[model samples]
Target: MPSHVAPTTAEVYRAHLADASTSSDVFAAGLAEEPAAALVNALAGLDDPPTVRLLVTETVAKWLRRDFHLASTAADLLAAETLSLRVADGSFANQMVVTADAVASILSTDEQTAGPATDDPEFVDSMRERCSEAWETAEPFDLRTPPRSRVYETLGDEIDPAVEADYQAMLDAVETTRSNGYRTTDDDRFDEVELVLLAGAKHELQHYDLSRWGEDVGLASKATFSRTKNRLEDQGLLTTEKVPIDIGRPRQRLVLDDRLRDVEAGDLPEAGRDVIDSATE
Candidate 1:
């Protein structure tokens, strides 16, 4: 049987199950992915399974979008999830909180770069609760909508400087970009989920990968993801190649082609419902 914490997203599961024996022998074959064994055990012990699963699902998706979606493979994201999984048990949680300056250091930034790691206990605790949920359910989260961190409630009216600055910048950028006739997938004025998928795939450092784009921009059902991806591929916005790290596998990594980038930059929803409609057909 597939492990409880393994990805339940149809795309991932369908990809894994291409071979009939892949499902039953996944663990023995060393193919068990994130929410690994320990994390699942921890979540299985939690009082509320559904809510915890939802939280972790959102966090994992957001973390992937923010940090790991650019990875050549799923390895980096999986590694981060493994470390964050430590919150499954109280002793480990206490140790991490007491010994570490940031109680939820693992929740935010990854190993390489420095960023504002969360210190708020309530936020961290909420992360822990979400982590428990991810381990329990093991599904991909829709990252189109970001979850609130509750930092404002924890620290009175004043927002964290980083957050405050970001809020102002976003507001300013909206006016500037809107006036300049620039619109992005994140702007919410567009309908094609593909635009949001593209935005999520892009990294701050001019990097991108399409490993989880379909799931993160998901709607209605997994079939929609597959169909949309297929149409986008046909439109020459998405291409595929052998995995750079695991070249022997049947898996083909999705690449962002120049066509989509050009379209995204040229006009705001100029492609219109026709782009999405053709995909549905």
Candidate 2:
């Protein structure tokens, strides 16, 4: 149970489930009585269960690409469904707004960085309504053939400018090295490392554990991502720390240094001093 004022997307998803008890307990608890709860359980396999909203969002994405074969339609449906969820009494609605803002933020990363952290609330609120109709039902709603490119054209759009600036600094540091050129065999690895950092930064902001992050980032293996993460730590960009709160295996957690965390929190100006002080402390 999260505090009701604009629960994070993660919290919204979590509140859907019945407790830690077994399925028997869930059935006995009568979660079947609620349509929204039942819909969530039927889709997610647990009554009153917690789920990542991204799961729902991406499910709509996949269905758009594959089943309905209409990428635009799928996006539309998901956007719509998520919107309706927001207006409902459940916390899912608020989470939907957060997810929409995140998507918009990622889409608009190249803009000026010094806003009041409180972005367009009305626009974000509108995304809920606008998006809900877009992804209203998961039924075969494909609209067009998805482009099969692994290197998405939109990748650059998703990169955080702060992360990009930090990586560019790293690139500048290694520019004279024979192995640092984009044409070199290691360049792809470098790109992957930056991507992992970006993904990791988002994870830190969203508070997704590493395993969940791996799933969200669509990595082939959590271990491989960990290896890249360690390489980043070696480069002094991330911290290879463990946390007991991580539901994943021991040594699987990665903590972004305070500097990066500040950037994610829209506190980048303070981030410079904070990062140094925290790292040294």
Candidate 3:
């Protein structure tokens, strides 16, 4: 028989959340601030589109129910910690504490291996009580909006059908980029919003007015998108043209520059890095 292969830490946690039979109230402890952040980034950056949406949506729903919590020794990390909690539901339904090493496994990009886990009732109860006490003294923090769900809720109500279709198309393009192995959190230069703009510019094969695209994505403010777009242009990766409109000032239509014109939708991340690298040299 083939040697037993362990499910990845991500796979383990995702399964726990998907199992309705598991306990709803979940607690995680022992993850350091850095690894905790990486875990969230990895979940958000998963290659499968449906899995990405499912994990984000499930984790956020649990968090909203007050059924999920993370404890850390670093009080200053709470704000960022809460964001990670929004991304991960729990490792095991019964276990309240996870080792830092296990978290590192979750963040690993290599062949995913299972981390240590347990379902012992007494052990879980003890850990849960300990974590609850710790949480009482922990600094207060509020959960941020779940990144993936916020996209849908933000764009759910477009009055113009054509505009709504375009928004969906751009979002699809972004997913395509993800499938192509571009991770927003992994890339220091371009964030999720920036990737959306670049991928949209390339794959959509049409120009979107900057403000409108930002409003539709709902991930960042229009002003943020404007700033990011300007930065990308400065780096020679993007260009914009003014389009005549029926009202107000001419709209700026986002376009990928010559460097990115030939890049396939899936090859964006690599191509983007090359352009950004060449510009700085």
Best by the lDDT measure: 3
TM-score of every candidate: 0.24, 0.26, 0.54
By TM-score, the best candidate is 3
Better of 2 and 3 by TM-score: 3
Against the true structure, candidate 1 reaches a TM-score of 0.24
- Please list the C-alpha lDDT of all candidates, in the order they appear: 0.30, 0.34, 0.44
* Best of the two (1, 2) by lDDT: 2
- Please rank every candidate by TM-score, starting with the best: 3, 2, 1
Root-mean-square deviation of candidate 2: 18.8
Q: In model 1, what lDDT does residue 240 have?
A: 57
lDDT of 2 at 43: 28
Model 3 vs truth, CA RMSD: 10.0
lDDT of 2 by residue, 164-191 (tens): 4443344333312121212221232243
